[model samples]
Target: MSVQNRTPSWPGEQLCNSCFYTAMRTHGVCPRCGHDGVLPGRANRTDPKPVCLTCASIPEDYRCRTCAAEGQIYRGGRCARCALRDDLTALIVDGAADPATMSTIVEILCGVERPESILTWKRSPKVRSLLSSLSSGEIPLSHDGLDAVSQRTQEVSHLRSLFEHHGLLPHRDEYLARFESWLTAKLDTIAQPAIRAPVEQFATWHHLRRLRGNSTPGHASERSMLSAKQQVTASDRDDQIPHLAARHPPSHRS
Candidate 1:
C-alpha cells in the first residue's frame, strides 16, 4: 500500500487571507504578519522598505515614520508632494504650477488636515521660497498665498451668506456669543505666556474697533439733540431766577 502525503491541520495552522506569509500556529497568531487578526493571510513582506501609497516612487523609509508617508506630510500622514499637487490645482483653475512651489504650501494649508503640517511645511524649501518671494514683494499676495487666504476669506463670506439667508445679516449676537465662548477657552490658557497676550490684544482691538464703528449718524444726531435740550433748560433756569427777583422787587431797596 502506497502512503499518500497529507497536510496536517493543526490548532494554529491558519494562514492570513491577504498575505500568505504568516502562519497561525499554536498561538493562533501569525508572528510573521501582525495583521492576521483582520485577514488570515495578511503578512508583512521581508522587503527592506515599503513604498508610500500616494507616491509609489519614494522609499517607505523616506516617508513619515508615523504614517509611513512622505513630503509636506499632513497630520493624517498626507505626502507633501500630494499636498502641493492639490494646492496647485486649487490655485490655478487652469492647473499650472507657476513659481513652482509657492502655491503648494498655501494649498496644503488651505485644506489643512493637521495643524502640525503648517510648521513642517514652513520649514520646507518650497515654503521658504514662497515666503521669501512674499517678503520681497516680488509675488503678489493674490497669487502667492492666495489659496490659503482665499480659503479663509471664502469661509467668512460663506458664513455671512448663510447668516443673511437666515435673516441674521445685521445680527451678530450669535457670532459674538460664540466668539466669547472661544475667547473664554483661550483666555483660560493665560498661564501660557506665549498664547495669552496676543490673543487678548487682538480681541481687545477687534472689539474696540467694531464698537467705534458701530455708532451711526442717526445715533450721533440724537445725542447732540439731547445735549442741546439740556443746555436750553439750564438757560431757562437762570432767566427764572432774574424774573423772580424782579417780582419780589428790591424789598429792602431803600
Candidate 2:
C-alpha cells in the first residue's frame, strides 16, 4: 500500500531529505524557506534522482532522467558516464555511458569548438548510423563497436570542418549518396568476372573448352574409352579432320 492509498484524504507528500513531510506545493517548489525552487528528490546519478528538496539530496520520487534514457542504472544525478548530459536531459528531459568507450567519444566531440560543427558532423553516414544503432538498441557495448564509434566521431569532426571552410555543410542525403557511390565502386573493383554469369553455364563452357584442348589422337588409352555404339555423322567427322591432321604431320613437310 502507498501513502495515498493508506490515507484516502491524506494530502500527497513526497520523501524528503530531512524527514517524512507533507505540504501542498507545485513542482520543484516547497513550503520550506530553504527549499526554494528545489524539488523532492536527490540525484543518485548524473541524470537525476530523487533528492531532498532542501539540500537536493535523495530518497524521493523519480529516477535520474539520463540513466533511464540510456537504459542504464537509476542511481542518482549526473556522473562521469553521461555523454550528452545537458543535451540529452534537455531533449529527452533525461539521458551512462560506457565510461572508457564513451569518454573517448566525448573527447572527440569536445575537440569541436563550434556547436554547428557538432551538428554537421552528425550528418555523416557513419556517425548517423552509429547513433541510430544506439537509439534502436542495436549497438553492443563491445570494444570494437566503441572503437568504431570513437574513430567515426573524429572523422565526422574533420569532415564538418572541411565543409564549413568551403561555405556550408551538406545534408544527410548528400552524404548518403556519396557513400553509396563509393561503396558500389569498391564492390565492383573486388568482384570476380564470373559473379554476373550463371554458374552452371559458365562451368559447362569451361568444361567444353578444356575438352577441346585436351582431346587429341595420340593417346590410345583415352581413345579406347570412346563410346563404340555412338553414331558419328559426316559433320562430326568433318569437325575431327583439322584435329587429326594436326596430330600427325604430313609424310613431307608442306
Identify the candidate with maximal lDDT. Answer: 1
| TM-score per model over all chains | 0.19, 0.21
Candidate 1 local distance difference test against the native: 0.37
**lDDT tens digits, residue span 145-170, model 1:** 33333323433334333333444344
Q: Taking the tens digit of each residue's C-alpha lDDT, what string does model 2 give over 1-254? A: 01221112212333342243222122453333444443434333364433334444332333335543211121344212343344322222223333343433444453444333454455467766664454344555333344345423565445334433433333222222222333334334434433312222222233323333454422222232222112111212445445434443343121
Best by TM-score: 2
Q: 90, model 1: CA deviation in Å? A: 8.2
lDDT (C-alpha) at residue 221 in model 1:
35
